[model samples]
Target: MKKTILLLSVLFLLISCGKAKNKAILQGKVENEQIAIVSKIPGKIVQLLVKEGDFVKKGDTLAILDIPEVDAKKSQAEGAVISAKAQYSMAVKGATENQLKQLEAKKMGLKEQYEFAKKSINRLSNMLKDSLVSQQTFDETFAKYQGAQAQYNAVLAEIDEARKGARIEQQTMALGQQDRAYGALQEVETANKERYVIAPQDMSIETITLNLGELALPGYTLFNGYISNSTYFRFTIPESQLSSLKKGQEISVGIPNSDKKIKGKITIIKQLGAYGNIATAYPDYELQESLFELRISPLDLDEAKDLITKTTVTLSL
Candidate 1:
């Protein structure tokens, strides 16, 4: 009976253990920071500043492109700024007195001719009223008077426009065109700076895909650099056992066959990709499927630097 009792207890513990959950371990690559230097515009790579394994700091120039066209556009933009300023100055300073004098003289000459034509037309009209002038002569004089009046009015309008000074509206439009051209030039300069690739931050230069004199196209990738200081673990997980792990939960990581474990905090779990269904053992839980990536930072992981890029480790339950 004692033997039978022991067997019953052992079966009880085994059955209870079957109800517990275990998360499966998934493998993932370790990456901290990767800065990819890509071509901003299509052009031949005129200069390559750093080699593979070269160290770089933030904003350090690495590569350059051969784009004379970009340079030319920048020069044209500078010219536009100067042109706008000149126009602005001219508009502020009104036409000179000498200019006004010449306009007045022209207007007076037109007025004198107009007055003479008006008197001739009126005299002929009176003659027509009394049957003294022929219809043809009266008509000709009337036409001449109309032409003179039109000429006088045109002269008066010109003189008035000059006295009014240069129009601010016209000047504003001209200045705006110049400003837009300059703005386009600034954009080209920004793209040109990228031609000389700069380090986004202090990083370990990883790979150099091309050497000097390579024809680089827009969006062509040349190098991959990783940040030197920031380190984190990447975990790949299967569809099943994902729910067993949650962000903010503490995890135990240990070397293979070792009893010592280091604590790590889970930071991110991907909601997409491979996934598993909720435990069917619980009748009330909804069934869902998805894949995920887990990220964690180790506690007191100063020694983690040496173990970084480690291939073997187990996730403890």
Candidate 2:
């Protein structure tokens, strides 16, 4: 009777161990898709409007940067635009009334000189024909007459040009300069808008990389956090157990120490190429067996939206 009792007890213990191994609980954690907010230009943070754990929507102002250089550039561009516009206007319009009057007065003086020089040359020419004056004297008078006539003709041409405004080519060049200045001013305005750091999408702030008054470089991530409504569950299992789960399979996940049960669907079943990529820190599967990642999305996002990320949850296989 004693030997029979001992045998029966060993058999019972073996059965219990087998049942325990079969009922082993599989576990995973909640995760969310993360994003990084970066600046396109370098500047110092003048004001930080959001903090860790703050929820923000798209287009919300998250911070303000103090880029003194942009302000200076805007001023310079504005001045250039003003100067270019004045030059273009001047090119389009003829010379001012006062300027035309001054040219006219100068022309009148040159005309008088020309007439006086012409009479002196005529008299010298006649005198030379009779041997009354030297050839050198007549030549000097003729040179003076030619100089006066050239001066009068140049003045008339100058007056005509002043009335006709600038040439077509000159007007076109001035207009081009004005356009270039406007383009520069627009570029500066765009940069000035960058001073306000706006959120690209709805997200929950997890970390702020820079503090107030800290300098942020171009392409530097200033905020790091998770996108809104992006929570999902990640599980790692051995290939041997992968047959039990299929893509698009619906499953129930239970939170440990809580009564909440979340309904989720398997969306991804991919083999982990490296050990580091495994979701579980300490896997219970055989070392030789290849690990696979199972990404399950919540069927009802509202239920899982408030779940703390990276928290453990149990799955029954």
Candidate 3:
């Protein structure tokens, strides 16, 4: 009778242990999609439109930067554009009426000089033939006539060029310069618009890294927060028990100290590195086993929107 009682007690203890192990619960944390809002240009924070914990929507103005450099650059660009436009106009149009008149007057003066030099050279040639003038005198007069003739021809050519427009190649080059200047102006304008930092998406602001009047560098994150309607559950399970869960499987997660349960689908099951931290303080599996991360997305995102991030949640295997 004594032996039989001992055997019954042992059997009861064994059964209880098996039941406790089968009902093991895994602890996970609630997480949300996060983002960092950064600046593309360096500037000082002149005005902060939003504060921490403020909810913002897409296209909303979050902050305003005072970029004095942008203003100066814009002025310079405008000047460049005006200068380029004038050059382009000059190339397309011929010389002005005043300029043509000046060229014509100069041509008339050169023509008179050319005629006088021609007469002088003819007289000197005759004198040289009659031995009245030296050969040096005749040569000097000939040279003066040649110079006057060249000057008259050059002025005529200049007047003709003024009548017609600039060469096609010159016009093309001027147009290219004008385009380059315009492009620079556009670039400066785009940078000027960056002074108003706008929100890219709807989100809740968790942190403000800079204060008013602080300098924000390029690519520096000014705000950090979670995206709206992006709550999910994260769990770390050892490889020994990985077979119990699969991607796309539906599961129910429980909130600690609350009766509310969330229905979610396993979206990802990825292996974690050896140095990665496990969510649960005491994992059930052996230490030698590899760890894996399980991400479960809620069926109804609205239901999980109010869930606090990094809060403890429970899941049964």
Candidate 4:
């Protein structure tokens, strides 16, 4: 009976000590900075690189879209661009001098024909004056001269037209068309890259929300999720503790259910309250105020994972 009494007394003392420990009833949850993986453009999902709870690092591809259509369009545009370039080259380097010589020869022939028709018409006019050529012959000769003059004008216009538009200018226009086509093709290619979601940050991919073969598009349901490389729990201390919490102040972050721990610095300490009131003005102004937010960064973040988001433990208050 005496031994039983001693055991009961010890249990009561242990329970009393446990009740005396300080614990704040804080309503906080565990979560990393969840980054919503997004697609850059619209396309049908062709390949899913991960599933739910799959871990990934930065630059990891989450999924790829069916890009065959885009590829075909790009190819078509590319071919057109090539053809345009060839046309531009041809326009810049015009027809050879030999071809110009042929045109000049034709011009000379027309000139000779025009001169002969004019001389014939003049002779007919003189003949009519002498009553040697008939009126019908004079009229026909005049008409022939007019027709020859009109033909000469047409030929001269052709030569001028050839000189008006330069071969280089034509080539430049064709090159511009090619550049536009090439830009369009590049845009399509860029869209294709965006369809395959990649890790936007250097952190790990915490989850894959959608399954493989699922249709994913921009602004649609995302299939992948990410978080920061390092994670930390937050603590708010009274304004009185601001002086104590300086930059680079050593902090011990406790890990629950494991022997692991992270040593970090007191990276941030609010010098003023939410209303921008200084700490010295607090007691003179009001008693009802919220604690300032403090930022702490882990010195060794090798395993400072999102899993340790909520690390609630006894901190000097």
Candidate 5:
């Protein structure tokens, strides 16, 4: 009879303590946001500036890539720009001195031929008047004179064109070519800059996925880091207790096995499905029970700075 009474007393005390603790505290985990550093351009890793466990700040150089393909493309674009500029200059300046001189010489030669043909036609007409030359012969000579005049006129037009520079349409086309080459060069340079991987924010390098001389493909993650600002506490509570919580409301959190209590703000509250897995201090919480989730951020960053991630914590509302 004495043994039975002692067992009953112990069982009741254990149940009472569990109920008291569950009503006052909620369970949560400490977590930080993970960041993956990826490259936009694929290339061999030329240099690794940070190793695992290193702390880095925003815009810090993380690594460098050796991209021979980008260099080759940049070179081609530069050459194209030079060629386009020369073409544009030629269009704007019209013909060169040597070209103009050659056209003028051709015009002079055509003029001499035209004069000779005119004299022949006159002589043929006179012969025909005396009936010494056939009418067919005079007709043929007149045709020759006309051909020479037309050729001389054409030569004069060409000389004028050489003196005047290229046409407006030609100049516009050359300018477009130059613009295209410049745009291409700019694109290559931008991509080349991307090869120098840099940290986007303050973080701790958790992992280095690629080593020196390894190929890093485009969009592939090269490093994994933890963002300090993303640290937060997540708690699972019974839905019956959710009415007491609201976003942006301040609350006190109790750290297990430590006297250092952290001040936090209620940042989120959401209901979970009956089947969702969650971490909570309440041992009676079951899959069939209705539960709510709460996310809180530390109001005092310094106090929670040393907290290890993914560790269980207790929350007081």
Candidate 6:
């Protein structure tokens, strides 16, 4: 009777093992979206605003860098803008008061010479008719008068030019220079702004790689963190289970050791290639020869928001 009892116990154990092997429950993990914050400009970290594990909001000031080069560039740009503006103003306005005064004085001198020549020509004409002055003398006097008139006209043109403002093309060229300088100033200012590292989105600080007074290089990661909204679930399912699953199909996700249940949608299903090695994310599961991946996004994100990455969870068929 004791031998029979032992045999019954062995048989029961074998049956339980077989049933456990045939179970279809899969193990998956919650995948959190992680990112590395990097700096575009290289400089010494002057201030660190956030500590590890601190929650940061979008557009939060993460750190400040001391970049002397950027400061110098900003000053240079400011000077260039000032110079351009002065040039533009000069182009728009005519000559100075002193220049106008000098031009008028020269015009007056020419007018006086013209008047003197005219009087001489009149006197010479009267003398020539009276035969007192030779014909050649009268002709010379007439030429002097013509020369004086030409000189006076040239001076008048000069005065007009000095009074008028700059030409349209000149003004346009100065305006272009001013615009280009302004654009450069804006560019430098933007670069200076980048020296202060700002958080791109809401996330938790995982690790701060650099400390105050440490040199930060361009494109070097300063902080490693995770975005809250990018969390998802990844699972590897056997080929036999792929037939029941499809993209955009609604499925149930359950947490072990907890009563939490979340509705997830099948966002991706990829079959492995022939002779391909299965890249299992969760090492707790025994991998099969023919495997497919099922990537699911939670429909109720708030329900699964607290789940950490790599924590095993169950997926319902």
Which residues of candidate 3, in runs, are more than 4 Å off? Answer: 1-23, 119-135, 274-276
> In candidate 2, what are the lDDT values of residues 1-317, reduced to their tens digit?
99999999999999888755653567788899999999989999999999999999999999999999999999999999999998988788968899999999999999999999999999998999999999999998899999999999999998998898888999999999999999999999999999999989999999999999999999999999899999999988888888789999999988889998999999999999998777754567778999899899999999998899999877778
TM-score of each prediction: 0.58, 0.87, 0.85, 0.64, 0.84, 0.73
Better model by lDDT, 1 or 6? 6
Model 1 vs. true fold: TM: 0.58
Candidate 3 has its poorest 10 consecutive residues by lDDT at: 274-283
Worst 10 residues of 4 by lDDT: 22-31
Better TM-score candidate (2, 4)? 2
Give every collision pair in model 3.
none
Residue 219 C-alpha lDDT in model 5: 89
Q: List model 6 lDDT by residue over 117-138, tens digit each.
A: 9999998888899999999989
Candidate 3 on 1-317: residue-level lDDT in tens?
A: 99999999999999889756744788889999999999999999999999999999999999999999999989999999999988888778878889888998899899999999999998898899999999998998899999999999999888777778788999899999999999999999999999998989999999999999999999999999999989999988878778788999999999889999999999999888854567764566667888888899999998888888899998988
Question: In candidate 5, how many clashes are counted?
Answer: 1
Candidate 4: count of backbone clashes, pairs at least 3 residues apart or interchain: 0
Question: Which pairs of residues have clashing backbones in candidate 4?
Answer: none
* Superposed model 6: Cα runs more than 4 Å off: 1-23, 102-158, 271-288
- Those runs of model 2 whose alpha carbons end farther than 4 Å from true positions after fitting are 1-24
What's the number of clashes in each of the models? 8, 0, 0, 0, 1, 0
> Top model by lDDT, which number?
2
Q: Clashing residue pairs in candidate 6, if any? A: none
* Tens-place lDDT digits, model 1, residues 48-156: 7788777788888878777777778778777776776666555555556897898889889989999999999988888999999899989988898999999999988
Error of 4 at 119 (Å): 7.4
lDDT of 5 by residue, 253-303 (tens): 888898878889999888876545576755445456687778889997888
Q: For candidate 1, give the lDDT of residue 282.
A: 22
For candidate 6, the 10 contiguous residues with the lowest summed lDDT are: 275-284
How well does candidate 4 match the true structure in TM-score terms? Answer: 0.64
Output the better candidate (2/6) by lDDT. 2
